[model samples]
Target: MPKIALAQIDTVLGDKQKNLSHIKDYCRKAASNQANIICFPELVTTGYSLDILGTELWTFSELRGGETDQLLSSLSTKFDLTIICGFIERGGSLGEIYNSSGVWVPGGKSWKGTFRKIHLVDSERNWFSSGTNIPVFDTPMCKIGIMICHDAGFPEIARILTLSGADILFLPAAWCIHYKDVWNINCASRALENGIHLVAVNRCGKEEKINFFGDSQLISPRGKPLTSTLGDDEGLVFGYVDFNLQAKTRLELPYLRGRRKDLYNIDHSLIV
Candidate 1:
């Protein structure tokens, strides 16, 4: 069994200082609750309004070993917990920024594996460079797969990770109020279909013109909403998941076993 915490926080766009401070406070709260791994919403340090920032957004994007990454790594060490957080990443070359999610393992000196957003939504294409890698990472408690805001809508991402043996999935999102229904459906459907526990953390409050619906949630392998904070309030949502249960679900339902890969084929060579 593992306890997980989802921090549904309100963020000020481009305010790294304010946002990082808020994250520390929630990390303390989550640590106090004895959570093994805690996750924050997408773009927790900088908020999700980068498209509005134009070239100024590049100023906020941090290189892999930058200050924000160091701070989060220290937080993970201080709390002795694994944290999956979203941040804007600067590639090796100039002007190459990505919408990326990363992990801070408790004993590691730096942020571990990172998963950049592959599916950019609407104006997001104008802002961040899309990622191609779908990486799964190892934590002390479980094998985790990472997803950013728009990635959750695509079933292939989850299926690919599930096929790679990710026991739990983390979705860090800034899902807007208008698409609240889609958010719920997507989260539930992903968990039920994949048979993996999901912790989908969303931001609260408004960032400029976008009003984010703070519905941070934790779902079981069977798609049960164990704990959720569904409103415009910023807070912590906690839930417990057992690997034994996940194993049981796979054994009983066994959808992956029955999957007809031969009949359902999407040729990647023909499509982008």
Candidate 2:
């Protein structure tokens, strides 16, 4: 059994120092609790209000192995735990920015792998470019897949990852209060249909005009809520993932095994 921690906290707009500080504090708490892995919400490093930042959002973006990565890597090493968090990534060329999620493993010097958000929603299109590749990262504990915010709404992304042999899916979202039902349904539906463990973390508190409801939860392969933090507040939601239970659930449910790929004539290009 692996212990997972979801850091559902409030983010300060465009304040890297404060955000990083909050992350470190949560990391310390998770480490103290002997958590194997900890995940933060989407755009946690610089807040989720893209329109408020406007053109200045680029200024907060950092290249791979930059300061934020270094700090997170060091923290993972220090705590002997895996850390997954979302950040604004600076692409190879100028003005190319992405809403990306990074995974830092224990004993590593930098991010082990990163997944950019393929599904951009609303204000996200104004600042970040949509990701092309859907990557599943392998770690000592398990094979992990990442979904940032709106990506969770697309069933194809989760199915693709499940097909790619992802044992667990981590969703880092900045979901608004209005779409609370969608958030819950998507999280449960993805986990149950895919027959895989899903950990969805959402940020809490208000940022400018949007209010975020923190209902971070860990759903079992059977679509049951193992652990959750309800209400819009700053806190850590913890749960345990049993690989044996996941395997058993998959065997009993057989959702993935029963998939009729032959009957589905969906065009590849039409997907995504």
Candidate 3:
């Protein structure tokens, strides 16, 4: 069993210093409690975006390997914990931006994986480019996967990660109040479908007029809500990831073993 901490943090728009301070507090608390991994919400550095903030935010953003990357790299090494969090990434000369999540491991350089938010909700599409690739990685704790906020709404991304041997899913989201309910559903559904642990950390508080529902959650392979928190409060929620239980459940059910992929591939659109 692996103990993980999900930090339901309230971020201030364009306030990197404040966000970093808050992250330190969460990290300290997680360390005290012996959490193997500490996850944070989407765009944790710049906060959830607003139209005005998006226009004004580009100047503050950094390309990969810049100051922002260095800071996260240092934190990952210092804490000796794998840190998974979201950020605003600047693509090269193409002048594109992405809603990206990064995975940082201690001692070694952080392996950066990205999700560009395939389903760009509301005003987001105006600012960021859509992500194309869905990837899952092998972590020390387990085979892990990363998906950004809106990607959770798409079943294919989760299914792809699961198919690629992802045992645990990491989601960094900035879900608004109106769509918060759907976010919960997505997390549980992904866990159930994949028969793996799912960890989601969502941003809370006001980023302009949009109030976020901060119900960061951790769901088990059994599709049970192991731990969750809601509303605009900032806190750390901890839960255990039991691989043995997941193994047993998958062994008994064997849903993946029964998939008719050959037939499905012939025409994925065909109703079963």
Identify the leading candidate in terms of TM-score.
2
Residue 246 Cα positional deviation in candidate 3, in Å, after optimal superposition = 0.9
TM-score of each: 0.96, 0.96, 0.92
lDDT of 1 by residue, 1-272 (tens): 88999888888887889988988898899999999899998888887776677887788888868887898899899998899988888886658889998899898888988999999988888888899999989998889999898899999999999999888999999899999999999999899888889999998898778899887888878887888475779888889988888889878878878899898888879987
Give the range where candidate 3 is weakest over 10 consecutive residues by summed lDDT.
108-117
lDDT of 1 at 176: 93
Q: In model 1, which runs have C-alpha deviations exceeding 4 angstroms? A: 268-272
Q: 149-184, model 2: which lDDT tens digit per residue?
A: 889889999999999989899999999999999998
Off by over 4 Å in 2: 268-272
Error of 1 at 184 (Å): 0.9
- Enumerate residue pairs that collide in model 1: none
lDDT score, residue 249, model 3?
74
lDDT of 2 at 18: 94
Candidates ranked, most accurate by TM-score first:
2, 1, 3
> Which candidate tops lDDT?
2
Model 3 / residue 84 / CA error / Å: 0.6
lDDT of 1 at 13: 81
Q: On a 0 to 100 scale, what is the lDDT of residue 175 in model 2?
A: 95
The Cα error of candidate 2 at residue 152, in Å, is 1.0
- Cα miss at 111, model 1 (Å)? 0.5
